[model samples]
Target chain A: MSSLPDRRLLESWQDPKAAPYVRIERLTKKFGDVYAVDDVSLNIFQGEFFSLLGSSGCGKSTLLRLLAGLEYPTSGRIHIDGVDVTDVPPYSRPVNMMFQSYALFPHMTVEQNIDFGLRQDRLPRRERAERIGEMLDLLKITPLRKRRPDQLSGGQRQRVALARSLAKHPKLLLLDEPLGALDKRLRENTQFELVNLQERLGTTFVTVTHDQEEAMTMSSRIAIMEAGQIMQIDTPTAIYEFPNCRFVAEFIGSVNLFEGKIVERQGDQVLIEAQFGGLMRMRSFQPHAIGTPVMVAIRPEKMRLCETPGGDGVNRLQGIVEDIAYLGDVSIYRIRTGSGLLAEMTLTNIQPRTEQALTWEQEAVIEWSPTSGVVLTE
Target chain B: MKRRSWPLLSILVFGYAFLYVPILLLILYSFNESRLVTVWSGFSLKWYGELLHNRQLLDAAWLSVRIAALNASVAVVLGTLAANALVRHGRFRGRTGLELLLTAPLVMPDVIIGLSLLLLFVTLQQTVGWPDGRGFSTITIAHITFSLAYVAVVVRSRLARMDVSLEEAAMDLGARPLTVYLRITLPLIAPALLSGWLLAFTLSLDDLVIASFVSGPGATTLPMVIYSSVRMGVSPQINALATLVVALVAVAVVIAGLSMRRR
Candidate 1:
């Protein structure tokens, strides 16, 4: 997991005077009539692990391809390290890409595959061998150097692909679903290793991934995209805890959204008159006019079993547990409220399941503080 | 294990016999001591020794081999280019028309192709003052015209199935387009190239109608010689030549199969 403290130290994007290493200005890519990347402008600082997070066909991969110079933008310009590389071919650009398929040349051995880029640059034979040796050792794949791609397992092939792409020592690297082919256990382990590799090498990395957890675990900042446009761009914690819009809130993680209209405003909090017959108070920084329609987005874990039922009716709801999923660490209760809305709440399994207090069809009351959820206008 | 059915076994046996019986008979009679191919007096190698010493038959066979080799080499280059254009360049302008033109030779009758190529060569000779006599160069060109189509068909399927990312990955790692094609693309599609080259060589070697249509004086190929001699009379020497051809083809097939299995 990427803790907030670790990311706070690497927030170069927060510095107003920091210059971006990779700057994409209003980039748009059209395949025939459909816009794959539509006027998307973004800036990535040097040494930052940036991720373009989206579902398949949402243009995250297309955007990464544009950065790699694999796909030319239909409009706008791309600048890498203060140079306009918009019109440069992929080979001429100072960048390398790891394809999602791990496109290792089937005819070549691991050593030859890693040596391909070095040979292209016409490096000296001795230096080429040295670089190849370093890459094999760095990726811990020296034993498989003589083996062809078909002889290697999926994980080994992935390492070979990574070593080959990194052998040239490009300033920036682009990865398209780098860990996508691995199984669940391997993927989780590789995620941390990949982040550590990027940190040690100090190479600016831009990765495209559909898995939100992978993005959250690795990226310094994530750009959430939808339908060829970015919905939000922020740190993982900020994006999860305080999404600017309903789509980002729903897309990142499971959140219970209560549609409402603002009826009251305090110093820094606004009271929402929910459609489900409740007044929900939430902290807000964005200015909103009275009677403006909005939504209060709250995570399932933020809601808790109410201790005082009659204290306040502001953020309290009465419901009957319809289903209980007994996960080892936590149990999720899907409760049907009085207004027929299914409200989900996850509680840590402190006691054994056999002695659990709440069961199916049991009446329960849940409550949350005003600062627990954000008020979204869109 | 399930027992095999009698009817299915008989059908399989009949199918193999129908295909191989003529080849088997020809091979068996190649060793016949009798002058008549229908009768076998005793096993002998006399015909093979005489066939090797025959000057005209040997000359014609040498010419055919040279023409087939040259034609296969040239056809492989041109056909591979066409396959690359079709498979790598995604649906360019006039793609459908080019595809139709490339495939037309596959369906066109051999006689029609031979006649059309003869006409083309004659016109080019008169107007462009090239291919002065329809001998080696002209015959090879004619063979290439039709052989290229088959080569293109074989190479195109392979090029289509190849992962385009391999080339892209090469380019991404600082290899230029030409270097990427040479190192990554060509090596990956080499099996298809080899098979295509062999196919073109076999097609050119065995072709009779096209060679007859375009060949001038003193430019007779092996098939033309074999056809003319068979028309004159059944020669035991020709039987020996046919058996040698069959043996060469069998050795080639075995080698190809073994190489494919190794990969």
Candidate 2:
């Protein structure tokens, strides 16, 4: 599959002159005294595929429902294509949603299911038939046209749902955990297909998913949500490389955080006295004064294990390998440092079969580059 | 395993026989050549022919069919509305009270239901000068009142089991609420409605107590005529009528089961 063009090259959210296609301002929804979505403001550009990423009950799905007009906001305004649709009913809104259940009409055949939206719009009969034909071909389900939803497999049902939602050609498409029901392999394949489809159609797509890998792979940008609020929003790589706070860093991927206080500051490097990992020095662009408590967050793959001591132990430590997890393409090692902190490291197993490797309980030196980790304040 | 299954099989056979033997005997004796019910000299269709010639029983049977059909239709419409309100309306005012009132007749004693309905019709006639005198309309109304409970209970369970997202998906696809109900919700719950209607029809057709209490002199239903005839003596004509009723119910049940499978 060809790689998708990076829509984030024009970071329009940062540019004041660029107009957003869909804008939500101060969106909040409450269910009896508890807020499901709280004061979320976001701008999605045309043809951009954005994902709201969070665990269950974190308000990601609720936000998507608000965009689809499935759920009314308690206090907010939503504008699609410059028209306010906050109070518009779902049937009147120019947006379609692919439900998590797929929600294919069990009584209708695949073709009939895809044609339902077009029929609801009162399109002419010929045009409705043509659109349904196109959708059948696009989703590669022409052979299953005569079969009801119950006859199709999970992945086929999902494609049919996608085809139905897209057949209407709405200004925006909302997906609620679109691939949540598929097996791992099908989910991985469908993710790229969804991105490609969005690119071809040029419709602004907003998807809600708890799978961080899916969001990182398909979304032009992702919003990390926590407790009914957005914690961070950025391109996937940016979010992974430079999470603004502890929650964003931990939520996106696995990380080893060393809680410490800054003891000394040099030109661009700082010396930190970590409570568990001992004294360490690292370079960061983030500016923090001396004696400020902070977290040094480093991804598992960023750390390198060595058989020998390296250069006076700056950004390095001697630790015993406590455990080893041998995944097919890579091996993850958990190391217990002399200071009693366990640091996890992932390494690609590229060596030949004849080569020996470090086993559990062996002492080794683990080191990372000075610029490899980020400084988190919260 | 043999020891365990043997007793279980015996219980199953005994249960079925206990339930079906009387109906089987009635059907068999309906064709008995002898006048004595216990003596089956030979099979004959004389009683069925006699039943065809009795104008009173035929008229009563025809009236029962009409009332049951009308009652089933009215009960289905009203019961579907009640079921939707109970299942879809989230925590509305008096929801629990309305639910209790709708389902109470399902478990309420038939004698109490009949007497209460009789009183209600009498009061309505005296106060509003309506329902001039109990006849076809009163019998149909009474049947609908009790049948509504059974239909509503069946439809409510069905509506509850349906995924709410299906309707929401239709709405998101630009179907208005009414259109969604027609295109998605109705089709999904049709089987339940069919079974509910069939149940209501059978119940109304077989009812004697409620019909007896609410019915006036001119509207004698099939069950009332058959009961009065049997109170005098067990006639072969009554056995023939009972056999026909059983056959009709079996056909209706088979149709219902087949339609459920199609879904």
Best by TM-score: 1
- The numbered model that scores best in DockQ is 2
Interface RMSD, one decimal, each candidate? 1.1, 0.7
Whole-model lDDT, model 2: 0.91
- Writing each residue's lDDT as its tens digit, candidate 1 over A77-150 gives 99999999999999889999999999998888999999988998999999999999999999999999999999
Native contacts present in each candidate (fraction): 0.93, 0.91
For each predicted model, how many residue pairs clash, with residues at least 3 apart or on different chains?
0, 0
Q: Candidate 2 lDDT, tens digit per residue, B10-53? A: 99999999999999999999999888888889999999999999
Which residue runs does candidate 2 get wrong by more than 4 Å? A1-11, A306-312, A353-357, B1-4
Clashing pairs in 2: none
Model 2 complex DockQ against the native: 0.87
lDDT string, candidate 2, A48-165, tens digits: 7899999999999989888888899999999999999999999999999999999999999998998889999999999999999999998899999999999999999999999999
